[model samples]
Target: MSYELSHLRELEAESIHIFREVASEFERPALMFSGGKDSIVMLRLAEKAFYPCKIPFPVLHVDTGHNFPEVIEFRDRRLAEVGARLIVGSVQERIDSGQLKEEPGANPSRNQLQTPVLLESIEEYEFDALFGGARRDEEKARAKERVYSFRDDFGQWDPKNQRPELWSLYNGRIRKGEHIRVFPISNWTELDIWQYIEAEKVEIPQIYYSHQREVVERDGMLIATGPFNTLGENEKAFTETVRYRTIGCMTVTGAVESDADTIDKVIAEVAGTRITERGATRADDRVSEAAMEDRKKEGYF
Candidate 1:
C-alpha cells in the first residue's frame, strides 16, 4: 500500500486526541482505573498524552471486594508511581450495609452490584465526566456507546436516544444532575490494545501471562482460586497452567486454559482465538443477550 501510519499508532493517536478533548471539555473528570491491562493501557495513554504535567484527572476504581490480589497490588503500586490520586467505590461496603445482596455460588460475580456503587460514588463526588476503559469491540451494548456517552442523574445510559458524534467532535452538553461517560478507546479492539502494549512496552499485571495456579473447570471456563470462590458440590481444584484474559470480582470472572505466559505469547494466542474477551471471562454478560445494556440503563457504570 502507501506510506501511512501503522494501525496501532493510528489508534494511539486517536485515543490521545480523545483524552485531551475530555480534559478540555470537562471541569472535573476522572479516569476509571481497574489496574487491568485495558485500564493500564489507558493510564499509559494518559501519561503519553499529557507529559511534563501530571494527568489532570483523578482515577477511580470500583472495587467488587472479589478482586484478584495481583490486580490490587498492581493498582496500588502504579498509582503510587504516577503520584496520582485514587478514588475507590466499594461494592462490599454496599453489601455490608444491606444495600446490595452478594451472589452465592462457585461462580459469583460482582458485575451487577458495581452499578449502584458507581452511581453512589458519582453522586458523592459530583463528577461530571467519567472516562472508562470501554471498547466497542468488547460487547454488543458497549459497541453502541459513543465517545461521549451521556447519563442522567440516575446514571442510566440510553442507547436509542444518543447524541450524534460527527467526525471527531464530541458534545459534552448536559443539564444539571446529569454527567457524561467518555471512552477514549471506544474504537479500539482487544488485539489493538495488546499490540499497543507490545509496541509501547507497557507493563501490566503478571496474571495476563501463563502461570501455575489452582483452577477448577466450571460450566465452560476455568474458575480460578480466590477467597470469593466458595467451593460447590463436586467442584475440584487442581493446579493448571493458566492466565486470566480479564480480571474482575473473583466470583463471576473465569480463566482460560492458556500457556501464553508472556505478553508476546498472549498477543499471539488472542489473535488466533475466535471468542471475544468478555465472552470468555465475563459471567454477568452471559446472563442474557441484553445483560450489559440493561445494567447500563440502570446507572451501572
Candidate 2:
C-alpha cells in the first residue's frame, strides 16, 4: 500500500529539510524566536528536524523590552522544555550605550529600533544563516522574500539582486560579514498554521486565546492598556474580549475583539477572516504603505 503526505505534512517535511540544510551548510546559524505563534511553530519544526539529538543552533531574540509579560514567561518555559540555548540582544542596552536612540512620544515603539539590534547581534555572534518564522502570506514585503534571503555585508536586503530558487534548490552562499535569512514556512498561511497547531497539539502563549482585558481604541485599532502604552488625553480604557492576531512590541501590536478561546475555535476564526493578521493588529505596519518593505531593506526581521 502507498500513501501520500497531507499538505501539512508536506509543509512539515519541507521545513525539516530546510532546517537540516542550514545545519549542514552554515558554520553558525540561529533561529530568530520572538515567543510568538509563528516562532513557536518554527521551534516545533526544529525539534522534529533533529529529534534524538539536541537542536544544534541557538535561538536568538532581539529584546525590545516592551513585550507582553505572558509571552516572555512562555518563552522562557518553552526554551527550557526544549533545552535550546538562548541568546538575547537587548535594545535597552543599545539605548543606554547610545547605539540606539529611543523614539520620543507618549507611546514610543521599539519595533523599528529592533533592526539595528538584530544586525548587531548577527555581527556579534557571526551567524551565517538565521531562521525566521516569517510567512509570505503575512505581509506584502514578506511575500516577495525568498525562502533563502541573502543579506549584504551591511545586513541590507536588495530585492532586485535576490538569488533565484529553482526546483526547491536554495543558494545559501554568503561572503564574510554577510548572512542569509531563512524562512522555512514561507508558504504557510495563517489558517494553515492554526490547523497545524490544532492537529499537532502544539502549545503556545495564552495571549493568542480570547480573554477579557482593558483596551483603548486608537486610530481604529484596539491597543491593550499596559506600561508600554499610555492613553492619550482623549482615549479612555474599556473592558473587552480580545485576542492577539500577531505578537510584537506591546506598544504597537493591537488586539482584535474575539471569543475564540480554543485552538479549534481560533482555527475557525482564522479561516473566516479576510484581513491578514499583521494588517489587522500591527500598528507599526500602518506607518506607511511600504513600512515592512522599508524595514526589510534595513535588515529588520
Candidate 3:
C-alpha cells in the first residue's frame, strides 16, 4: 500500500525542508519573533526541524514600545523555557535618539516605525536570512510573497520581481547589502495554524483566548481602551468578552467579540469565520486599499 502524508504532516515536512535549507545556506540567520501565535508556531517548527539539538538561531524582536505586557511577558517566559537568545530592537530607543520620528495620530502604533528598527537590527547582527511567520492567506499583499522573499540593499521588497520556486527549490542568492526573508508556513492558513497549535500543544499568550476587557468600537473594530489606546470624547468604553485575532502593537491591534477560551473552541471559531484575521483586527491595514503592499515595498515586515 502506498502511504500518503496527512495534511498537517505534509505541511510540517515542507516547513522542515525550508528550515534545513536556510540553516545550510545562510551564514547568519534569526527568527523574527513577535510573541504572537504565528511566531510561536514558527518556533515550534524550528524546534521540530532540529530536534535533539537546540535551534541554531536566535530570535529577534523589534519592540514597538506599544506592545501588550501580557504578550511580552509570554515571549520572555517561552524563550527562557527553550533556552533561546532574544535580541530586542527598541523603537522607543530609536525615537529617543532621534534615529526615528514618531508619527502624530490618534492611532499611535509604532507599526510603520518598526521597519527601520528591524532593518537596523538585521544589519547590526549581520543576518543574511530571517525567518518570519507571514502567511499568504492572511492578507492580499502577503499573497504575492515567494517562499524566499528577496530584499535589496535599502531593504525594500520588489514583489513584482520575486523569483520562482519550482519543485520546492528555493534560490537564496544575494549580494552584499542584500538579504532574503524566508517563510516556511506561507502556504498554511489561519485555520491550519490553529489546528497545528492544537495538535502540537504549543503554549501561546492568554490574549489569543477569550477574556473580558474594556473596549471601544471604532471603524467597526473593537479597540481595547488602555494606555496605548484611550477613549475619545465621543467614544465610550465598556466591558466585553473579546479575544485578539492577531497580536501586534496594542494601539493598532483590535480584538473581536469571542467566547472561545480553549484551543479546540478557537479552532471551531476560526473554521466558521469567513473574514481574514488581519482584516478583522488590524487598524493599520485599514488606512488604504494597498497599505500593506506599500509598506512591504518600503521594507515593512
Most accurate candidate by TM-score: 2
Among all windows of 10 consecutive residues in model 2, the one with the lowest summed lDDT is: 166-175
Count steric clashes of candidate 3: 0
Which wins on lDDT, candidate 2 or candidate 3?
Answer: 2
- Cα miss at 74, model 3 (Å)? 0.7
After superposition, candidate 2 runs with Cα above 4 Å error: none
Worst 10-residue lDDT window, candidate 3: 102-111
Q: For candidate 1, give the lDDT.
A: 0.87
Against the reference, the lDDT scores of all candidates come to 0.87, 0.92, 0.91
lDDT of 2 by residue, 1-301 (tens): 7799999999999999999999999999999999999999999999999998999999999999998999999999999999999999999898998989999888888988898889989989999999999999888888889999999988899988889888778889888999999999998998889899999999999999999999999888898898878889999999999999999988888899999999988988998998888889988888899998988998988
For residue 46, give model 1's deviation from the true position in Å. Answer: 1.0
Q: Tell me the lDDT of model 1 at 179.
A: 97
Candidate 1: how many backbone clashes? 5
In candidate 2 the C-alpha lDDT for residue 293 amounts to 93
Model 3 clash pairs are none
TM agreement with the true structure for every prediction: 0.96, 0.98, 0.97
